[model samples]
Each structure stands twice: as C-alpha cells, then as structure tokens.
Target: MTGSGIHLPMQSIEAQHLAELVEQFLELLRDTEIGEDAALNRLTPVVYPEDADASAEFADATSADLLDRRAADARVVQAGLVALGEGPDAPQQELSLAGSEVDPWLRTLASLRLVIASRLGIEADPSPDPDDPRLGVYEWLGYRLDLLVDAADELDGV
Candidate 1:
C-alpha cells in the first residue's frame, strides 16, 4: 500500500486464475435463482432467522438488490484485475487499486470466499482438511482477501 492505494504484483497465471474465479462468481450470481442453490443462499443473509415468513419476505424484498450490488462489485474487481496479466505475452502485471476501487475489491473478495466456503460445507473451521484439493480455491480466495484487507486497514489509518 502506498499513499494512493494498494499495488499488487501478480504473475500471469495468478492473474488468469483470479480472472477465472471472478468470472465464475459472476456467473453464479447471474445464473442461479433464489433457493435454487445452497451456495447462492450464502450470498444473502437471513434477516429474521426466527420468523420464517418474515425472513422470506425480507429476502423477497431485498435479495435481488443485494445480489445486484454484489454483481456490480464483482465487475469492479474484474476491471481492476485487468491490470494483471495472462498468457505468455505479459507473463506478469501489476494492479494499483485506489479510491473507490478498494471497497468494491474487498467486498467482492469476501463474497467470493463466502460462496466458495458455502459450497465446500466449511462453516467455522479455519482449516478444512488441506488434503482436500477442492479447498484450494477457497483457501486462495481467503489469502487474497486477507492481503487486501490488511492493505485496506493500513489505508484506513491514513
């Protein structure tokens, strides 16, 4: 993090992997309908956990807008990730995120992590059997999310 924003150094493969993940996340958001997938349910919180009817009503009223904003945030992440590289051409790239881009990146990372975690059936367990290869993407998102969060915290102090 600099006086302006967070500058990330990423390899081409890393960039491509991140791009793919975000793309999948966007597809999940746009493609899945409410109650269709448990993973999608992770994106929306139960406002009234005790009252099923109220919770359903709350979700019915707000879930669409909430998911839409999440999609928008994911787009911002995709845009910032454009600075990262892919293929043998660039091999490597740097993305320096500043101003409004920071929050969207943070939110998108969190959302992606949540959806991935939900799909993996990982609740509070910090370590979800590293032996499971499928958990790789979930761990990766958490790692990236942590980096941005720490950087964002530094900027907050400024």
Candidate 2:
C-alpha cells in the first residue's frame, strides 16, 4: 500500500483495535490541557536547555500554535476513524484513505504515541521491561506508526 493506495482490513480484529486506539487517543486530546498536561509537555520540548529564560520565552511564543495544530490534527484523525467505523458493512470491508489523509493520520499517530510514551515514563526508563503492559501499548503504537510511515514513504517514492 502506497500513496493513496492504503487498504486496511476492516473485518480483522486488529482493525477494530486500531479504531479503539484512535478513539482513546482522541479522548486523551480532549481531556488534556494544552500547556498543563505532563504528557503534552513532551510535544513542546525546551528550546534552550541551559537557559531557562530563553526556553520559557520560546515556549511561550510557540507552544500555543503547536498545540493548536496538534488539536486540529487530532480532530482530523478522529473524523477519519469515525468514518471508518460507520456503515453496516464497515467491519467486513477494506477502508482506503487518500494520500492527503495519510499525512494527518501519520501526525496524529505520532502525537498519540508521544502522549502514551510520556505518560508511561518510557523516556526516562533506561531499560523498560518488554513484558510491562504500558510498554506493550507503547510498542504497538510505534509499530503502527512505523507501518503508516512506511506506506507513505513507498507512495511518495522516498
């Protein structure tokens, strides 16, 4: 699957799980406070690690715009997921998304993964146990995001 040629097996249990993950991601976006949520803080990293003043200034100027874009991406992702889940034959069908849709989906998936990874404190853990449930979810999200990116790259001839 490449370009606008992505085809997801809707009838599979994996597809259903992906839809549920999207829903959960949207819910997290809805509940998060742009600058207040610890999970979201990962989205806006420090611009000047050694200079608190400069970093704060940079963050103050750019955080809102970044969060706004992320929120919009989340909405797009939610709409796409909802559309996929609708209709009587949706489950037993193959859902195809256009090339244009792929970008936002990719961004949203990356954002969701960031949030989950941050919340799970995976970044700070030097060696997380693979058996941990949170690590499992984080790994799953990374795998799905990788698949999307690979598909997009093939489509773009990258």
Question: What lDDT tens digits, residue by residue, belong to model 2 across residues 99-151?
Answer: 77787778877887787778777686746666668777778778878877777
Structural similarity to truth (TM-score) of each candidate: 0.88, 0.80
Clashing pairs in 1: none
lDDT, candidate 1, 3-82, per-residue tens: 68877766677777888988999999999998998888988889889999999999999999999999999998898777
Candidate 1 regions with alpha-carbon error over 4 angstroms:
1-3, 86-90, 124-129
| Maximum-lDDT candidate | 1
Native-vs-model 2 lDDT? 0.73
Please give the lDDT score at residue 130 for candidate 1. Answer: 70
